[model samples]
Target: MTKKTQTPAVQKGNTDPNTLQLHKDPAQTDAAQIAAMALGSVAANAMTARSFAKGTFGTLDVTECVMTLKQRVDTTHGGDLKHAETTLTAQAATLDAIFNEMARRAALNMGEYLDATERYMRLALKAQGQCRATLETLAAIKNPPIVFARQANIAHGPQQINNEAISGTTTTRARKTRTRQNELLEEPQHGSTQLDDRTTPASARGHTAVEAVEPIHRTTKRRRESSGGA
Candidate 1:
């Protein structure tokens, strides 16, 4: 038979436990809120870095430097200078590609940030709207409800009604004015029409399509008559 082992019971502590408990103090919470606000403020005011790699040795105007080097390379004929130029050109192109890649990555990061911010803003707006609706619903249950009076005085007031009526009238008047303007534009004054007729070529202004073709028909008839006579 296998020997069985029994586990011993843990003894209770004889000393009293410390009364102190971990809790967030109001001051600490306030400090954290302030810190968060400061961070947010800093972020809001911060400018985008022009160079992705700051303090790295070399000029930021890589393209301009490359162009200047190319100009020098064009003038250079010595083997040593040509070799140096070729090396430099290659290095400059590589640097340009590096900066380009950095800029591309930065743009992608900015776009992602914008998308996140936009989504957060939309969610915030929706939440705010829901909260407002809830508040309004609660306010509506009160004796002589404040929202109803405010809505009646401001939102659905006589002034608003009058404004709507005036807007409609103005819109109708505008439409009529536009129609009159269009008619005036399309049908010029009698004197202006006469002036236009005087300035325009007779063939272009006066002749109808069929009337314009009459000259061609007359020429064809004359040719036929001559041919018959001959």
Candidate 2:
């Protein structure tokens, strides 16, 4: 007959429920209880560490717990955003109720006691402000404000704004030149007179048509005086 080998069973210790042993796996029941509790990270981790020693977590590790919490937060955030309008509207309504209650209490306490009345009025104002803020938030979420960029004329690829400017300047200079020419035309010419009785050279030469020549005199004042005296 062959000899049979027997293995020793795992040992269990009795320690304080609030204290953690340096080398022991946490009770499965404790892990389950902490996991089911709706506690924050700090409290949860403290309780979980105290419950689970030997750096052993049953069914879930610290990383797994963190990931589970993160997933839950993500889910909650998505749900909240999905129902943001309804949630904000409900919150606004609640604030309105609170405002009304505070106002009613203020009205009742008016003139009887200054402190109580002031406190109630202050609370009522605070509630009214909160309600307004909630409604504004809801409105913003529903119809977000559109940011309209200022209308701009953006030029691309080395656009020359000065091209048009130069053309405009040229046009202005041309106009000025035309104006000067017109002024010169309107002004009387020096030492020149119109002779209505003058006839064309062709008429004078018994021809049908031809050019006429007019003499221009360049006389000084002394010569004019001598001529006038003569």
Identify the leading candidate in terms of TM-score: 2
**Which residue pairs overlap in candidate 1's backbone?**
none
> What lDDT is reached at residue 110 by model 1?
62
Model 1, range 1-230, lDDT digits (tens) per residue?
A: 99889899888543322221123467677667656634642222221121333356333343333344446555653433545545545655554555455445445556568765555555545544554554454344333343322222356445552234235678989999988876675454422433244575333344355543344333334444454554
Query: How far in Å is the alpha carbon of 18 misplaced in model 1?
Result: 45
Model 2 Cα RMSD, 1 decimal: 16.4
TM-score of candidate 2 relative to the true fold: 0.38
In model 1, what lDDT does residue 13 have?
41
Q: TM-scores of the models, in the given order?
A: 0.16, 0.38
lDDT, candidate 1, equals 0.47
Q: Which residue segments of model 2 deviate by more than 4 Å?
A: 1-72, 76-80, 150-213, 218-230
Model 1 spans with C-alpha error above 4 angstroms: 1-112, 144-230
lDDT by candidate, in order shown: 0.47, 0.67
lDDT, candidate 2, 1-230, per-residue tens = 99789888879565344432332336546566555543556446655654565456443344444555456557667764545576788999999999999999999989888799999999999999999999999889878897744443558887534434235678989999988876665444522232323743222224458567678787666644454554
C-alpha RMSD values across all candidates: 33.6, 16.4
Candidate 1 positional error at 216, Å = 94
* Global Cα lDDT for candidate 2: 0.67
